[model samples]
Target: MLSRSSFLAVIATIAATNVVAAPFTYVNERFGTVCTFPDDIFTDRQPEPDNGDGQQWLSADGASLICSGILNIDDDTPKGFVAAEKASSEPGYKVTYSKASKDWAVLSGLKDGNIFYERRLFGRDGVIRTVWIEYPPAAKSKYDPLVGAIAGSLKAR
Candidate 1:
């Protein structure tokens, strides 16, 4: 019973509602690490840690995104970091895929039954900038496509 223009307007409104919002950039003051993510997906921003090392954001459905930096005290290279992650004893942590270059490393696999993707950049400032994103396996189709953009946005100042 709706007019043609009214029907089109309603459809447009619905489409707009389904669209994800623009991404937000977070920069770590201490280590100069930077990350970008869609804030609408990670709606709950947690309190910044006292050490000023990083920031974390959570979604309503249990997904989490962490942007952090750590001192490269051990002078670890990308390959060494990947090796260390693969050797981690953390319960339910398993690295199924890993790749490392001269200055960056990426690890993806299951962690506590959830899918996790992590990207780290070795900065010239003796800091390792990292972005870690994790979500339920059931939401792989939803989150997987967005991971690349989020991970690619990680950098160091």
Candidate 2:
């Protein structure tokens, strides 16, 4: 029941639809919102792997940096992680990685993407329990400092 032009126009529009890049949300709560981060602006990078380096994305404000490092649990530990932390109600190592944490909220895909492992720790009113989304160095070119900062600034509500 549609005209040829109308159908073509619809098809064209569909073809041209480019999904906007949404911000990657890692964590959010009464504490704060953590997302994809911006890197330090003062630093320089390799455009094409100069000296074996690679390219990276800069943050809008540019102070802290997010760089991908190798994903190795054997040789890595969570930053600012506390030996004793808390969750809804369980006795674990403070914070533990579970794709099914009620705390993650809608920050989905934290376990399905380049995030290799999630390091967890607990926080309280005036303390910090940091977590990490480990990825390879190649992915380091796309570090999410907002996410890191969120992990760095978490506390129990």
lDDT top scorer: 1
Estimated TM-score per prediction? 0.86, 0.23
- Residue ranges of candidate 2 with Cα displaced over 4 Å: 1-130, 144-147
Writing each residue's lDDT as its tens digit, candidate 1 over 29-144 gives 99888877678889999999999999999998889999999999999999999999999999999999999999999999999999999999998889999999999998877687
| lDDT of every model, 2 decimals | 0.85, 0.31
- Model 2 lDDT tens row, 55-92: 23433323222222222334322331222222223422
Q: Assess candidate 1 and give its lDDT.
A: 0.85
Error of 1 at 98 (Å): 0.3
Q: Which stretches of candidate 1 lie over 4 Å from their true place?
A: 1-18
Instruction: Give the 10-residue window scoring lowest on summed lDDT in candidate 2.
Output: 102-111
Q: Pick the candidate with the highest TM-score.
A: 1
In TM-score terms, candidate 1 sits at 0.86
Error of 1 at 145 (Å): 0.4
